[model samples]
Target: MEYGQPQASTGGSVVRAILSLLPDWVEWTVLSLIAAWLVSLGAVQVWRRIQYCRAVRAGRPIHAAAQYGQGRGADCLGSYAPPRRPDADGD
Candidate 1:
């Protein structure tokens, strides 16, 4: 209340200081997680491309869905009934 004297901060100043620091920590953690995810995605894409190139060089047609039996089921001619197992019910 004196002239030329600065006002002193109360207990709220400590709370404000802690609150301000919290955002910086949260921002850094989120940034690190996003960066890691992007790097992993890029690595997976490169690996897939390498595999595709290798398959092409081996004189075999590279069919992505071939592993799931896409065209191979045409011989059934609509008579295909999906195989059922008795244990599929988790009993």
Candidate 2:
């Protein structure tokens, strides 16, 4: 409140000073997690593109993928099979 004096402590400055105590790895961990998420997203896009190309070549109709897949899918049909029901389930 004095004409020429400045306040020694304020809430924002105190919070900023406290933030400097965090270790370097905390920042790297956050960055690493973000980078990992982005990399995985890019990988999924590339995979979908390859599968779409295959579908076009095979003439299965891309609309089948969109309609049945709700516009999204990752079915490697040739490499996997659906589960077969056991005879006991019929009893």
lDDT of 1 at 90: 25
Expressed as tens digits, the lDDT of each residue in 1-69 for candidate 1 is 698977658776885666577788886787699899999999999999999999999977787565543
Off by over 4 Å in 1: 1-22, 67-91
Q: What is the C-alpha RMSD of each candidate to the true structure, in Å?
A: 14.3, 12.3
- Per-residue CA lDDT of model 2 for 24-87, tens digit only, reads 7875676689899999999999999998999899987875524532422323454564544565
Query: Where is model 1 poorest over a 10-residue stretch in terms of lDDT?
Result: 66-75
Tell me how far the alpha carbon of residue 85 in candidate 2 is from the true structure, in angstroms, after superposition. Answer: 42
TM-score of each: 0.46, 0.47
How far residue 43's Cα lies from its native spot in candidate 2, in Å, is: 0.4
Regions of candidate 2 where Cα sits further than 4 Å from its true position: 1-21, 65-91
